[model samples]
Target: MGFRNFRFQIVVRVLLLVATVFVFFKIGFNATLVSTQIFVGLLISGQTVALIVFMERTTNRLIKFLNTIKYDDFTEVFTSRGEGEKFDELYKSYNEVIKKFKDIRSEKEATTHYFQAVVQHIGIGILTFKKSGEVQLMNNAAKCLLQVPRLEQIEHLRAVSPQLVEQLLTLPAGQSAVLKLPHGKERVPVSLYAVDLVLRGEDFRLVSIQNIQRELEDKEMEAWQNLIRVLTHEIMNSVTPIASLAGSVAADVQDYLEAQPGTQICLEREETEDMGLALQTIEKRSQGLVRFVNDFRSLARVPTPKKQLFSVEEMLKQLQLLFQEEVAHENILFIVNCRPASLTVLADRELLEQVLINLVRNAIHALADQPNKTLQLEAFQDEDSRTVLQVSDNGTGISEEAQEQIFLPFYTTKPTGSGIGLSLSKQIMRLHKGSLSVSSELSKGTTFTLRF
Candidate 1:
């Protein structure tokens, strides 16, 4: 019952007990006094017991209400529906407050899950850190990009690179920079982004890392393709007329010799021979133009995947034979150390062979100026159960400026280099579900590693 109704009932009960006492007094003087006292004592006793029961029930209900929220049991909280109207209003307000907290907790959970998924699924690497340089989040890509094979290396780098340190110090609420990670004897590139994050009412700088190497490679490829198109057109313009003019001049020389065979001097024969040599030069350049066209066509042809299980060691051995002539002529010593003999990788044979040849060729070229020119080709199964091949040289290592563009088509250091070799090799590895990468230090050496 409501407070107003319960109060009315209690008032009626007290009045009835008082009336009884008055009636008893009317019967006899002394008896009336005793009867009135007894009635009052009974009324007080019963009311006291009722008060105790009400207090116990109220306390238990309050305890249950608090427990339901504390344990996150968010069902309806209403119990003992018929009670003081004020108490009912109080319970309703408690329920509303409890639901608000529940909603907030749920939203927080969903947001956490969403961000976690985003960081994991993104193609680029991501690393998050606080303003104090504590690691917050790191994705698989970030780990791979940084060559962070262990947690220890990751922790160590937080203290190693000054660029990363400065980013943490001067990082505004939101900002980012690129980091050059040292791996072996070389550095890898990483793009870092930082933002201010408020956790538990405190602001922290959240730094994120990404690998923009792929993006850069893509842009470089586009630029080179455009350049190739323009160069091919211009060179063809020059080459075509030169070829025609050379042929015309040689023919005219032949006609003059034929018309005056008896009158022609020994010096004239020498002149004719000179003309022949000039024509031969034009012919050689024309042939080179054809070869250039063929290489460009090969790059454009992306074959449909035809995967097969093949031994990487066997592939390298075969490449050794393929380039045997060139290596022998260059007096370049070749060594192939393929161990655990049969490392079967799933890839296209032709494409992979081409990639190995390209890498070997690149190594040979790098060794050109070295006093002790030698290449080491090593192939084996890695700890991760992947096939690994390494091509290295003891030549003057790649410079920092050249390292960035090494895989870009037509980015060559050699006077006669076309520069499409490494770029094509990278594409071949990608098509075969593998990776091609390098590590180098200037004045020391360079190493190219392919993992499948």
Candidate 2:
């Protein structure tokens, strides 16, 4: 409608201008009406200029409105200029479209804020990063979990745990994995879940990290308790009777031998000797089996820790002294280091000592065949202000396969090992609200860390 009106105005101006020009030319040769002809010509030029200006004004307004929409500038208000009813309607339409755009933009902003709040307050750590490893978003939970104030790139996470950075980058969407991450002195097990995302045509990965250390410990402890209960019950029921019968048989055989001389019974000396030796063997084997069952019983019977603050320096010194003779006999170099000499840990000193002793003994055994044996006991505070005790050996390292099962009851690579030491030590650490972990490399050695 506006365009039609504009075209009609243009046609009227052209016709009026053409008529004035014709009038001016008809009187152009008459000297008596020269001034009148000049006035008519001037009127024709003014009409021509007005027509061009009118066309440009409408066209310029239309272009400006389009540009406003294109740049998302909803603040541009189209006002009526009193040109005509058609222009008034056009201006009103433009205002309504701008208002709608403003409403839509406001709604989008509110939605964004709502999601941002949820992401920030959620307990699970969330991290969103682009394909190039640039971190787009890291929620407060993620920052707290990683102990980083701010993370601009995923590579920065390598300082916390290199394995974690690798896992985050390579984890496939829709897949999940659980890994042990070293946080402070503690090894926290975290579960990772990844999702592929595309925002505005840019590829991204959304990974969620949740600490599952407590959950894992609970499940593991429950499994060990159940297994130990069943095994102890069944073994005790069978072994107790066998052990008692063996003792009774041995006593009966001795009495019978003493009474044989008075009852006129005679036997070959070799046969009598064989009978006595067999009875002794049965008694010894039965007793050993009973002791073995009792050892397994202890795994399920760990007591609650009676925690107290104790100096780490004194503790390491005591451990070193206790093993001084053995290390000397083995020609091993024993090193003890305690930073600050004043760091202390709140734990059951007795139980903590038991764990350290077990680790130290294992390290010693590992160094049995190494030409250059070294055993190190280190105590210090970790970056997160947690106390850490480490026992390391530079000797024959544990195999990768054995490292996985070293903390499981009855899982040992040593031929004569009772296999309860590592498992039992781990249980004690749990009672202290701490962790026991191991790291080893082939031919490099092993380190058992007790984190409190």
Candidate 3:
């Protein structure tokens, strides 16, 4: 209807102009009506100008509306200025279209921010980089794990760890690698997982970094604990009966020997003595087996820590005092150092002390063969602000192969080692929501770190 009205107005103006021109031409030859002809000519001229202006007005408004959209200037609001019903509708349509575009842009921005926030705050570290090693996005978790304020290129991580950079670059999609990177004085185990991404025809890689040191420790401890639980349960069940039977038999034999006075029981004195010795040996071996099983049982039965805040300085002091005699006898130097002298820890004091004692014992043993034996118990706060206690020794360090299995139940390097002490100590720390780790270099020294 608006189009029809526009066409009708255009046709009426054209017809009026044509009719006025024809009349002017007819009157052009009459000399006495020159003034009237002039006035008629002026009317025709005015109508022609008005028709052109009216047509161009709509065209100009259309151009202006297109420009507004082209430039994404949604702020422009088209309004009718007494231009008639057609332009009023036209202006309304332009305003509605602009409003829709504005809403779409606003929604797009909001969705973008929502996703950005989710990527930033997720616990796992996320990193997106191009095929050229240009880092595009790195989240807060990534920064914290890498110990970097910002990473612009993957190559920059070489300073942090060259192996990490290599793994990040060459790690295939759908696979993961656990990289042990040094963070301050501690070594952190990070699990890196990668997937290929293509955005806007550009290839990218999205890698997720997660500090799995604690998780790995927990899992390893769990596996050992489970194995020990099963073994100890089965061994105790089997060994308890044997031990009891051996003792009973030995007692019965002794009672018979004591009660009978030369009651000929098919035995010479030498034979009787041999039989008694055999029974005593059996009883002693069975009892020793029972004791060994009981020691391993402790690994599975680590009690929940009755935690309390205590001074680390005092704890180290107690350890030093406890081992004073042994250290002096072995001609070893025992050193205790706690920075600030007021560092404290929230833990079960007794349980923690037990762990310390085990580590210190191991350290002392490691230092035994060294000419200049030095045992040190150091306590301080780590970079992450967690309490750390280290027992170090300047002794014959543990072999690399042994270090890997040291925490496993029944894996001991020493000839007389029961191997339950380290395992039990690790379990105790786990119960307290802490970790026990060992680092050693053969012939250099050994350090056992307890992180809480």
Candidate 4:
């Protein structure tokens, strides 16, 4: 096996050195053994040089293996031929590890390619950029949205809209904004959402853009249609009666005048009383129609909210005080629960107070005749980590069909309701970049939640 086997190599070298030691001892004991001793010494030197050369080859092989791994040169092959058995086993293990690494790298690359394809094909525009405004990635949707074949920097978006560039650069992470960009002779409203990321120790912002003009237009048209339907219904209710009553009164007067045969026509007392009652009824109906129109005008003219920061617990306390007498008169149980009593929110305090009062009053009306009436006001963080203020009542609840239309302007279930309360509340929440939602079960209770 010669030096190809590590164990055999070590044994042969050791035996040779032992023989040289024996030769030296023989020279020490005998006088004329110098030539034999010289031959043994030469053998020892050659054996030592062979061992050194073997160690050098082993070191070179180790260095080559390290370089291959360092450079990720997986194509390089490690062979066991001509090396010692120990090296042969080591090389085999090295090959296995390199193959595993190569396979892992291939899988990762394939995954990366798949994600890249998805990102490019998504309908919403996506962009990744560094803090310096250098664009790292831009997909086809972004290119089409910007009307540019390529984008290397965020400043290039100024061609589409300079305002978009400013918003994209300055908007805080996790916030969204709407911007109107010039498109041909018209303007397109775009919604932009941004998130922060750290990649390879560098800060990057990933933004998503969507055109929301079509959606807004659709919702606006639907709202108008609903409003028109309500207006037509109210107008017809008043106009139909007015038209009929006027025709009847004209005919009755004509008949009276013909019977009298003169300009000064006289009527029976009962007829005169009937005419007076008709006129009074007409006047009352006209006044009611005028009041309806005024109510609608007020709904249309809600002022914009003036926002400020305020404590939630304090607000709840004030509401409790305001409704203390009402709750006591109704014999209803009232409860207030606040987690982290120092919780604060940024919103229009006066507008929010108005909304809360409307909600509580509605709850009171719902529980007017029901026994075991209970109202709860709560504040806490929801599962998504958003601060939520909730009002819950154990009284008559809303139906599914009615729930869907509750936020519509002038839609109310109460016998004497204006129907603008919920709609106005929803608008105020939107102004604060928050949301108002409700969950209710018939005959059980209703809960209204405001999230910020």
Candidate 5:
């Protein structure tokens, strides 16, 4: 490879020696010996010149072939580079590398396109953002949810809510979060889920907002209807008899006084006893109303969160421990399948303890007389979002119609059900910025999904 200048010099010297030898022989200076030396030198010079010319052409062709490959002009084959057997081997190696790079480039573009389209079309809002808080892409759902304009679609969402922005940045790179927006005169109660993404060398996030006001309203209405139905039944049962007995007592006293006006008892001793029992009945109904009010007071004031992190699995386990005996009495089995050996939440320990206990206990009661009375309690990180802890059960599922009403105080499905259990549980979940929902079928089972 370094022989160019040196080889050229040798060729020039050989040619000069041949010409000098020819002149010496013509001038009769050892003419025969010099002529022989001139002939040998001329042959060597011709051979050396031919070799140098070939080498120069070959190396030039190699440089041209390399340039074409570097530019990815794979259309033109490296005929010059691969002509000779030795050079052909080198050409094959170069060709392989070029082909690989081309393949990778094609695949990379395809993947990028696929990712863009797929991410954009998903129902959940997807946003691609830079690590420095610049938005790269906001999908249709995200734009609509955040009220992003067409012109401002790709623009940095600096005008968004600061709480949302703060949550986006503060949550772990791969974690998710839920941001709440209360209902205003113009705005609806919105629940936004912020999910983070780390791809290639970039960071992005998805903020999925779902309108939950309607769902809550539905659940609330259900609870109210159920409560009213049960309460009306209870109150009427008490009030109707009280009114009848009071009327009868008054009539009896009037009759006795009218019949035997002076020095005679207004009513017989049995009548007096009957009147006393009727008054006691009225007091019992009044007491029932008072008890209902007290339960309501407790339901309204959920425990304030001592929002420290604690294991959700541990919570369920403890509930199992507390209610294991009850489950055994009903031949009910408790199953717990949860993630993180320690699935924890930032909530008040005592409050969450009671909430879980109530839900689990209610679940046991729900499966009261079913053929297969089994309760499965599982706490898992949400499939798409890791920050949420979802607790679900497989018991006697609530019907679509009844599922709506299960949360009202005193709204129980049991024959002697008091109905306040689910209402209190829902309030606790709300205190922790969580939710409880029931999805049930006729006879199969009920699944109460608590998301926190």
Candidate 6:
């Protein structure tokens, strides 16, 4: 009904202004024309103002739409229907786009909240910080462990441990380190690892810290218990025989002296031989116990490794040569596999050899009575890009219970097992900053992995 066409409205406003000007000029300087001229002038001014307002309708709506977006006020709908079909469609499009953006922003915010909750609820203490010592996030565990109610900056940990802040900042991704923090009378050991991330156009480091004090204590206690059990068993075996034999020997001597009736002891030949045999038996048992104790000592006092880089193939070849005779005599199929041919590792050559030799010997023993016996020694890179030396044997596999205590000192399944081999191997691996682990199942096989 009004000037619905935008271009037509502009043309009509111009025509009205032109007509008003012509009428005023044609009737200039006359008293009769004054009222008419004033009326026309007022009409022209009114039309001009109206036309300006009409033209700015779309601009005004656009300004309002932009303000809504700037303020993140998406509740208002940019809807128009009456001005024209084109204006109606334009407004509808704006509304649709804004609604989509609102939905996306809502979804993004929800996802952010979900991850935030996960990070907070994890058991490991997590700290996310910027390069400038500004802490972006610190989980509840982190706050408790650091003994602070809140963390705003990494430097706040300086009081906890003078080097903690510096270590965390400089820690490389994928590598882990341990830090000791003073906790009252004792020091707490915290294992730390970090990952690098870029968020919101800025770099941040997410570090995880956990106290390993409880874990170390548990391991220590278990080791002591195992040691005590072994010591008690060995000592009892030796002491029991000695006690019984000493009493028998004393009675035998007293009987001989009493029967002599001359204040002199004279033992018969048979009695002398019997007592000497008993003494020899006691001496032998005592020596055996001494050797047993020495073995335990050796297991406990493993020498520190003198590490050197050596080729895996060369080591395997040497082992094969050293044990070739035994393998042949036992009719065992011994295999050595080294992937990439030139694989090498940095470790003490002698210690590593001892570990491998112990594992191989154990495997050989297990396969002694088994048919189709096979032992494989392999060296390759594992999934984590770490070098692994594995010894696998298809022999009588270990029971689940035995496997649990296999690495414990003085714990063994074999009858005459000194029980020090596997434990010593594990200690050697630890000294090399490596790991020794075994996987076995009854009737399937056992695999011993040495990871570096």
In terms of lDDT, the best-performing candidate is: 6
The digit string of per-residue lDDT tens for model 4 on 1-452 reads 68688778778778877877777776774547777777777877887788788778778878887888899888978897665778788999889988998898899999999999999999999999999999999889888777788989899788778889999999999999998877677888889999999999999999998989889999999988999998887788887897788788889988887888866887789999999888887888898789888878877777787878889999999999999999999999999988889888878899899889999998998898788999999899888778899999988999999999998877899988878889888888887889999999999999999998
Worst 10 residues of 3 by lDDT: 1-10
Cα deviation of 376, candidate 1, in Å: 2.5
196-293: candidate 2 lDDT, tens digit per residue = 99999999999999999889889999987967764675567557766776766677677777978675667678867776776776767676677767
Candidate RMSDs in Å, in order, are: 16.7, 13.5, 16.9, 4.2, 9.7, 5.2
Clashes of each: 1, 0, 0, 0, 8, 0
The alpha-carbon root-mean-square deviation between model 6 and the true structure, to one decimal in Å, is 5.2
Write candidate 1's Cα lDDT for 1-452 as tens digits. Answer: 43445456456656665665566555455654886667666766676567667557667777887887788877756644566566677678878877887898899999999989988788777666554556667777766765665442234666557566666557665556666777568776677776676788765655566666678789889887867765676477659877787878868777777877897434467776877777777888887777767766776676865889887777878888888898888888888888888667788888777777777877888887877778888888888788888998877889878888787665677777776788788888888768999898986789999998
Error of 2 at 390 (Å): 0.5
**Candidate 1: pairs in clash:** 127-209
lDDT of each: 0.73, 0.87, 0.87, 0.87, 0.69, 0.88
Better of 1 and 2 by TM-score: 2
Tell me the lDDT of model 4 at 189. 86
Model 5 alpha-carbon miss at residue 141, Å: 1.9
Which digits, one per residue and each the tens of the lDDT, describe model 6 over residues 1-452? 55665557678888988888888788787897888889888987898888788868888888988887888888878766456667788889879878987998899999999998998898889999998989989988888778888988888788888788878988888789998877677789989998998888999898999998889889899877877887798689789988899889989878777778796677678878999999998898888888888997798789989988989999999999999999999999999999979899999999999999999999999998888989999999988889999999999999998988898877789988888899999989988889999999888789999999
How much lDDT does candidate 3 score?
0.87
Q: Candidate 2, which segments miss by more than 4 Å at Cα?
A: 1-266
**Model 6 spans > 4 angstroms off:** 1-52, 73-124, 139-144, 147-162, 172-176, 184-186, 254-261, 266-268
Which ten residues in a row are the worst by lDDT in model 5? 149-158
**Candidate 2, residue 203: how far the Cα is off, in Å:** 29
Candidate 2 has an lDDT of 0.87
Model 1 residue 313 distance off true place after TM-score fit, in angstroms: 3.5
Q: What is the lDDT of residue 403 in candidate 5?
A: 76
TM-score of each: 0.50, 0.52, 0.50, 0.81, 0.52, 0.78
